[model samples]
Target: GGGVAAVLSFGVANRLFTEPRERGRTIGTMGAVVGIVSGGGALLGGALTDLIGWQAALALPGLSALAAVRVLRIAPATQPRAERLDARGAVLCLALAAALAVLLQARTTHLKESLVLVLAVLAVALAAATVWHVRRVPEGFLPRLVVSNSRFVLAAVAGFTLFAGYLIIQFAAPRLILMDHDLSVTQIGLILLPTGVVSAILSRTAGGLAHKVGPLRLVTALTVLSAAGLLLAALAGRQPVALVIAVAACVSGFSAGQVALMAAVPHLVDSSVHGVAAGVFQLVFITGGSLGSAAVGGMVGAMSLSTAIGVLAVVPLVGMVAAVASALMVKRQTQAPAPAAGPTARPAVGAE
Candidate 1:
């Protein structure tokens, strides 16, 4: 639960640092650290699990709690407000998400036909209810200001698809290597270890690159890189080198794209709703990742794993359109006609 709760803090990244470049740099450094640590952990996890047991592979994340304790000193203070919780809207939103989750899992879980029917009905009902609630209360559980923004949508979609691709690679690579190679668990991890190295290097530079290339192009390029990785895995993944390259491309794109794009959220949305925007983006990230893995797991039984991955590539590709649109939107926003105000009035940055 602590691990899950930890995701909630992701929104704080935007809140912590105000400067765009600084935010980018910090997020990139974070990506680097995570990549390096994860790479080492992957190599070690295999050896440790074989030697000590699976429990050894799982004990390390607990250390993050200690890091959190020290971090509290720098955490932002709470701003008390008297607005009541939108319990009805919250319940509706949760039900809607739950319904969608059930549908995504249905294929993998292979629920009974009757159960599927019930779930389908529940999903429709929940969807309608949630939509009605949102319309009735635009500023309720899901704020209009947050959800309606194109940039926020891109952030959500980018995180969603990038993570989907990330999860797909994670599931596909190890399985591919184990099927063809007679390598030890540790050896397989070693083969996959370079993904982390590649990811770390790219992550470290992503911020500066995004600043240079602009968010739209950078995100599209990364998405293309990710899709190419998936395509390689589908077409030539039997070769260990191909799989390694595939995973590297996929992970590097995910790591760099996530940090760079998220850092740009402040430029797109109002400061008051940064938290909401971040929360929505991360929620979509988690959902899309789950759905991505679920898509692979559900389809691999009926289709080739490679084909499933090729199909999965569409997730990021669709997100690329959103990313491009987001960039265009940013351009449009920046180019808005200056207010025809008196000389005494300063220009205000519009936060739609």
Candidate 2:
């Protein structure tokens, strides 16, 4: 329910703001709110767990229900589309995510080879089925319209790697800090709190920046900044300054990258598919997060934490390269001479 609800914010932004800068600014404000809330929640949940029972932290999510009232009040007026519900596709998606989660973590965690092989086969089967279903029912789960747009697909891929690196730093950093400093979870949370405050401001700044600097360039630079953070962690995580840089970089990357992508989506695909496009784009990237977290958990026992983080840097580094390539390609295309069009020439997508 939360995941479904999460996707709606971008869709609403897309509907409400047609201009790129305005939408970017709106999404940045939204991202800032998320950063502050989640950062505060980390501290609150940690305190609750330490001061009271672990179960006390469970109440935090119940507080989230209060937001639904606001959601109802502000969500754009929307009508239900009458398309067939993609039940099979939805089920396959859940199954595939679960299977892949298990399989990815199975390796360095030392699961029985036979069990790993079985889960591997199951994941492959589920992934195959999902692809077949999406292709067979293009208008269903993943929508042919959204998938066909190269910009949309590229943005999704960039988002996935950005999140993968972010989560890797998140999962890896706290454990390393605890191991090194023996800090309480609450203290760690407090130490990280500034990241949220700073990132919130930077994210909001990114909104205005998007108007002057191409969003793709900002995104690529942010991704590179995150990868560099991980590299610093790999090299000097024991140092206080590097640790702060590591945590702050990844958090900023995700917060600002999300704003950039959210604003870019309306320009990537038709507004008609805005809702689904935002949903699928989020799912892909957040799923990358899950994998990154799993990778750290699976590999920590088998390798040095620094080595694990260095390995993690590769994910976002890949994203940075893709982002750079995409920006260049878009620039070249933008500069190229327009083909002579007949009466039916459609305006380019970025014109929106």
Candidate 3:
């Protein structure tokens, strides 16, 4: 359900803004809201569980969703159009995703080595088949033109790698704090609370900065900052103050980078395919997070947590390189002559 919301929200965001600068600001504002909610969620959940029960805590999202429905009803609607649903592509993608999840889970479970290998092979095969089939189908589930754009491809890579690093911190930091310091859940939440606050404040500023500095450069710089945060986490040991500072840095960088990446998406693809492109971009983002969590979990099971974190620090550095490449790609594309309009080229529905 969260995944569905993410895809739909991104699609809506893409259609709602055409000017890159405005889009950046809008996305940054949205990121601020997300940071506030996510930052407070842990503390709220702990309090609710303590006061009432776990069931009440679990119902919070449903209540939020109900409130969202009220807002959505009053929102302006886009023109509806019909397109053929690519059933084969959909099935293949679903199968591929499931196989990959199972493969990842297997690494942390007591599954036999042979079974893990089989799941890995199945996932790879499904992925290859999905790509092959999508390329052959005109107007397939995925937008071919958007996928083919060098700028979009690099942006997707940048999103994936940076998000993986962020997820690693999210998954590891709480565990490290509890294990090393023997802190209560409430205490842990308090220690990490500053992260969300810093993220919310930075997110709003990041959009304007992206508008001035360019999305690629902003993303690259934020990613480098995220890498530095991860390095700090690796060396933080049991120091509470160091951990708080490190986590705040990670959260701020991650939030800013995410907004910049989202702002760049619409410019990289034709306006007509905004919804599909956003969905695909989000899918990549979620996939990276899942992979990061799985990789870190598996590593922790095999070695010391600090050692695992230190190793995973390389992920954000990779994202930094990808961001640089994306900047170059966008520059090259902009300098090149404009190509003839294809089937996907249409005026954006909600350009202001």
- Flag regions of model 3 displaced more than 4 Å: 18-21, 337-352
Candidate 2's TM-score: 0.90
Q: Which lDDT value does model 1 have at 1?
A: 51
The lDDT for every candidate, in the order shown, is 0.78, 0.78, 0.77
Runs with alpha carbons beyond 4 Å of true place in candidate 1: 1-6, 84-98, 137-141, 339-352
RMSD of 3: 4.5
Error of 3 at 48 (Å): 2.3
Question: Candidate 1's C-alpha lDDT?
Answer: 0.78
Q: Put the candidates in TM-score order, highest first.
A: 2, 3, 1
Model 3, 229-341: lDDT tens digits are 77888888457777767776667766677788876765677877766777887887777777877888877767888888888888888888888988887788789997778
TM-score of predicted structure 1: 0.88
Tens-place lDDT per residue, model 1, 1-352, is 5324435556566668777777788778877876675556668889988899889879967777898897787877768868778899868766766676676667668888899899899989988887787777877877878877777787578767887897888888878777777887788888888778988999899888878887667878888888889999988887989998998888887778767666666777998886776666666766676777777887887788889998888888987888888888888889999868797976568844
Clashing pairs in 2: none
Which candidate has the highest TM-score of all?
A: 2
lDDT of 2 at 214: 74
